[model samples]
Target: MTIWTAIFLLLGGVGGGLLSSIASMASLASYPVLLAVGIPPVYANVTNDAALIWTSIGSTISSTKELKGHWKETWFFTIFTVLGSIMGCILLLSFPSSVFEKAVPFFITFSGIMILVSGKHNTLNTEKQPTWLRIVYLGTLLIMGAYTGYFGAAGGVIVLVILTYITNEKFIVINAIKNVISGFANLVALIIFMFTSHIYWLQAIPLAIGMFIGGYIGPAILRRVPEKPVRIFIATLAFVQSAYFFYTAYLR
Candidate 1:
């Protein structure tokens, strides 16, 4: 790519990573930049996946504090994340995302509202669950993981709501778990995509670099901020993401 294109991608990555680390939405900042640089749609999608790995890496590295006690659960659930991602990757190779894309706006908007209003309901610590309920929870995670493995536009927001509903962990802890596990899911998709020709590494590399920097910085900011403002910020981003995708999926 040209030096200017690299610079633009780098900047895009920074914004994407910052937003991703903070609110689980990166495409809002990075995906359009990939398309703007003239990469084909499928090419941009794969390249976007490649670059996003760095955001997970950067966020995980800096989020050690948030992830501390949650290590066991994170690793345990990541197996399902990997498995679901394999299915998603296989599906993506065979299917057009048009149908799923049509449903994304509603999911994003609903998840956003849930998080915003999730005050007392979300604050409750984990309660003992029955055996059947646990199975249902795992099944849900698998589905969400598959979604993350797919286009992953607002998958994080959906995950944020799901984790909150099931575990009811503190928001920061839930976010940390989401980041680490989602990284593994993306890793599975990356491995599958690596053999394909769609990934434009020239575009992905600079974006990854910028994303890593932003991801590394975001957790530190989150650590000091109060939860309410962060919740509002994420909810707002979700609404914006929902509207943009709505236009792309239907209004257009």
Candidate 2:
């Protein structure tokens, strides 16, 4: 609530936003920052999601150019994401915190393994994916989106991994659509969190402001950076963070 805290949260938001544009792990950064600033874990997670929601808006705008005539295709996944988010959050709420504690390590390790083994495979598209396989892809996303709504650290990465199988779009475009769908998923969860969970509004306000600016600048930076390295770096960071978070959650 102090001016100093406001300043820090704003800085965290910008950093978080930039990360989001690249990898969708903004929550991993800002959640800890909020906790370090004295917000409880529950409040920190909720507020971080609230702040990062703006990144989705910026990403959606940037992605619209790439999507061109593909909005219809995107909508089907978006609708599933929205519904899955609701279901996921409900599932999360149904469990005790201890359940999340036990599952965090498994979630993180699975994601890390997927990235390490499948990064090369990610380059392949769905030119040959059969109809049944497409259903599997959609189902995976829906299930993962639900997880994202519940405890989304690398939820965007989960979507990215799945999408790499279905389309040959540029990673940036895939990331942008992931943002929109995940944003919608989080939006629904945010509404529920506001009612059922504690939210650190004072922290979120500054973070949201910073994220707005960062999200706007991320794509331009991406254009200037080398693609393969950026993707590799992000994947590495996500894996490391997931490991750390899982470790911490397990110890709790």
Candidate 3:
């Protein structure tokens, strides 16, 4: 790889990791960088997925305080997420990318609205969760896993929003769980992608290194910032990203 390409990817990884940790929108940073560096869209997507495994590692380590008592739930959800990611990988390999590209903006916009609405309410914390609610949560994770494994633009935001409504925990804790689940789901997909010829290893390596550093820094920043502002910032970012994707997919 050229020195300039490596530098770009490393910088992209750092930015992607920070965003992924803060907003769960790692792809928004990394994917475009890949494209700008002249990687094909399909290869860039897979390469980005592979590199994101490092983000999970960094996030998991940094968020351990919040994750302390959540191990059982974490493992429980991970199984389903892994399954969903595998399915998503299969779909990506088998289907046309256009179908997902068309649907992404709507999904991102809906997820952002859900996060905003959920943040304003106390329903998730006050009410006793029923068995049905647990089932619903599981279902949401499965779907999110598949989505993250496939297209993955703002998949973390979607996961965070669902967790917000289902769990009574603080937003930071929910975000920590989101990181674990996202990491594992992507791990499954990365393993699958390892066998494929699509991953651009030259780009993926530098990106992974940068993301690892960013992931470690992300939770530290979260801990220092107030929760409300972080939520607002992430929600706004989601909406803006959604609009940009919409314009690119249809208007452009």
Best prediction by lDDT: 3
TM-score of 3: 0.94
Q: How accurate locally, in lDDT, is each candidate?
A: 0.85, 0.76, 0.87
Candidate 2's error at 244, in angstroms?
A: 0.8
Q: For candidate 2, lDDT tens digit of each residue in 23-84?
A: 66787567778988988877777888888888887767766676677677677778878888
Looking at candidate 2, what is the lDDT of residue 224? Answer: 71
Tens-digit lDDT track of model 1 for 149-191: 7767788777777777667667888888888888888888888
Cα lDDT tens digits for candidate 3, 91-187: 9889865778888899989988888778787655425778887888889889888987777778889989887877788888989998998899988
User: How does each model score on TM-score?
Assistant: 0.94, 0.90, 0.94
Q: Which runs in model 3 stand beyond 4 Å of their true positions? A: 125-127
Which residues of candidate 1, in runs, are more than 4 Å off?
Answer: none
What is the model-wide C-alpha lDDT for candidate 1? 0.85
**Model 3 global lDDT (CA atoms, 0 to 1):** 0.87
